[model samples]
Target: MVERRILIIDDEADIREVAQLSLEISNDWEVLTASSGKEGLKMAVAHRPDAILLDVMMPDMDGPTTWENLQQDPTTKDIPVIFLTAKVQAAEQRRYAQLGITAVLTKPFDPLTLADHIVQTLKWV
Candidate 1:
């Protein structure tokens, strides 16, 4: 199988670490992490990962704003993005979906099941 590259963008160090370890161990996927939206956008453009897991609430640049920027950039616009957020209200989910994200994974997620969630959501397997 081809190794997948996933970029995780979140301000929390613990969240980034957990996501990286989860994806790496469960899916054998190469994972890149960024602490802020600006850094994440830079990495997304530079690496062009297969998918980006972005945190909704972030300082300097929120996920929605960052996603808009990504959509404007030709190099990163086509890459799929999945929102990782604590906000799971029906209205908010609808809002996120309207933004054209591939999917949204709620916070306090199961580390072991994260890869499976992504795969099922994206139909990667």
Candidate 2:
């Protein structure tokens, strides 16, 4: 299988580390991490990963705003974004659907199944 590169944008250091490790080990995906949306954007443009795992809630330039910026930029607009939020609200889920994101996955996820979630969500199988 072709190796996939994923950019993980989250504010928490531990969360980023765990997710990075999980994806790398499970799928052999190249993982890049950023602590905030700003840094994530720059990395997204420079690296142009296969997909992005964005956190919903963040300190500055939250996930939605960052997604918007990504859409605006020609270089990053085509990259698929998957929301990785802790909140599993139906209202937000509907909103996410309307926004045209790839998918939304909740936090506190099983590390073992994280790659499976991505694969199924992206229809990689």
Candidate 3:
């Protein structure tokens, strides 16, 4: 099977690295990471990843803003986005939904289950 591509957008280096490692070790996935929304957008256009895992907050451009920009670009609009954020309030979740996010995964997530969570959320099982 061809490895699925997943783009991770987050300001935290550790989080991005950990997620990349977790998914790579557990499954056949091509992981790409960006440290900022700007970089993420650029990468999204070029790579056309199968899925995007975005952080809610970051310096410069936040996840929502980045998501908006991605959606505006025809090249990446159809790609699914899942918010991997620490902002886990009911209202915050609603806000993510308002942005048309496919799913939201909270911070401090279990590395072992992370890929499964994403698969479940995306209904790829």
Candidate 4:
């Protein structure tokens, strides 16, 4: 199977570590992490990863804004993005869905099941 590259953008170090390790081990995928939205944006453009897992809150350029910037960039516009957020309220979910993201994975997620969730959501098998 071809190894998929997943980029994780979050301000939290532990969260990034958990996600990177989980995806790498569970799916044998290449995982890249950025601790800020600005850094993440640069990495996304340079790496052109298969998908991006973005956190909803950050110090600069929150998730929605980051997504908008990504959409505006020709190089990153087509890359799929999945939001990882703690905001799991119904209205919030609806709002996120309206952004046309590939999917949203709530925080406090199971590391063991994260890859599976991504696969099922993205139909990556």
Off by over 4 Å in 4: none
Error (Å) of candidate 4 at residue 103 is 0.7
What digit string (tens of lDDT, one per residue) describes model 3 on residues 38-59? 9999999999999999998999
C-alpha RMSD (angstroms) for model 1: 0.7
Q: What is the lDDT of residue 80 in candidate 4?
A: 91
Worst 10 residues of 1 by lDDT: 116-125
* Model 3 worst lDDT run, 10 consecutive residues: 116-125
**TM-score head-to-head 3 vs 4, winner:** 4
What root-mean-square deviation over C-alphas does model 4 reach?
Answer: 0.8
Cα displacement (Å) at residue 67, model 4: 0.3
Tens-digit lDDT track for model 1 on 8-105?
99999999999999999887999999998899989999999999999999988999999999999999999999999998999999999899999999
Q: Write the per-residue lDDT of candidate 2 for residues 1-125, one digit (tens) a residue.
A: 67999999999998899999999998899999999999999999999999999999999789999999999999999998999899989999999989988999888878999999888888887
lDDT against the true structure, per candidate, is 0.93, 0.93, 0.93, 0.94
CA error at residue 47 for candidate 4, angstroms: 0.3
Q: What is the full ranking by lDDT, best candidate first? A: 4, 2, 1, 3
TM-score of 4: 0.97
True-structure lDDT of candidate 2: 0.93
